[model samples]
Target: MKKLLFFFLLMPILIWSQSNFDKAEKLFQAKKYQEAQPLFEEVLKSKPLDIKTMDYLGEIEAHQKSWVKAAEYFKKLKELRPTTADYFYKYGGCLAMRAVEVNRLKALGMVGEMKESFEKAIILDPKHIPARWALIEIYLQLPGILGGSESKAISYSNQLAQLSSVDGYLSRGRIDVYFERYTLAEKNYIKAHEIGKSKITFQKLYNLYLNKLKDPKKARELKQKFES
Candidate 1:
């Protein structure tokens, strides 16, 4: 009789929790993050280890630019789900953003862990595109004395190409632009635009022409063609 009574009492709470979660998810999807956050917190209080709730909270914090708080959530997620590539990637991204806000020495100290996290994400999922892109940026931006290498960046770009031709061309264009090899960048971006023909690809080529190459005529022509 007591067991039956307990079950009946618990059922209402469970139903309410589920209902709140559903509503919170809807708000989150609608980008009403401010409204969704408190509800998510409420749900977390009831189900402390709920992965989806935790992940949502992490993303909300990240969107709000609360990097340290977001990092805590994602770090917990990575620890709880070690084999999940995306969790590691998100954790690394949070750390990288946090590094940018800190003192240079502190930021430098964070570099190894950031690299390791992204590398682990790649190792866990060989075809993970975002992780590869993150690695490419890291390699490109780091100084040679701190282990930066253009060759390393190119290798990841090659890998991206093998996985996605559009990404491959776009990344190569980025590398060329970084080195101020405007003509080379233009060729790569043009190839990417030809293959992808999307807004992003078109913007890449347009920006290169207008900003880097200082060819306003080419940029205008490209823009016209894209619009047409």
Candidate 2:
């Protein structure tokens, strides 16, 4: 009777456990994210070495704004398979997001971590465009005194240029802005604007005019033009 009771007690748990993935996926598809998290987590606990599970869990954490946990999961993924660019890319991207919600020095430290992860991603897969863009953003934001230079940034950008035209022009403008060369930056940004019609292009121009170029008039013009 004890064995019979034990088997019955375990049946519900086993059935639910077996069906957890399907349940979680259904919830995820329905955007019932909170409902999905625990089941996916339970799956992870049992299958600790499953990289695909880790990737989905990391993505779910990202969607839930759990940046630190997401980064941790991605790091675990990298540890399991260090040569995968996707893992490093996700790790760097998560760290970058977490950095935004913290204090200055902490954010700076996260940026350093982000850069290292991005470099690793590039080393693993030189053609990973998203990883390339992450590196581009780092080189642009980091200070020259702290191992950040426009020249180095520009070189990386140039390598990216060969892959896509829009990316190329955008990168060139970024390099121009870094060196306080407003005219060149402006032209490249405008060209990017023409090709992509993306708000990012003009946004870059606005920052250059306001911060680097020290010309509020041009910045104001861009703001007015772009905002419309």
TM-score of each: 0.96, 0.73
Badly placed stretches (over 4 Å) of model 2 are 1-18, 175-183, 197-228
Instruction: Report the Cα lDDT for candidate 2.
Output: 0.83
Question: 126 in model 1: Cα distance from truth in Å?
Answer: 0.9
User: Tens digits of per-residue lDDT for model 1 on 1-228?
Assistant: 999999999998888888889999999999999999999999898888989999999999999999999999999999999999999999999999998899988988888999999999999999999998888988888889998899999999999999999999999999999999989999999999999999999999999888888999999999999999
RMSD of 1: 1.1
Candidate with top lDDT is 1
Candidate 1, number of clashes: 0
Question: Which parts of model 1 are misplaced by more than 4 Å?
Answer: none
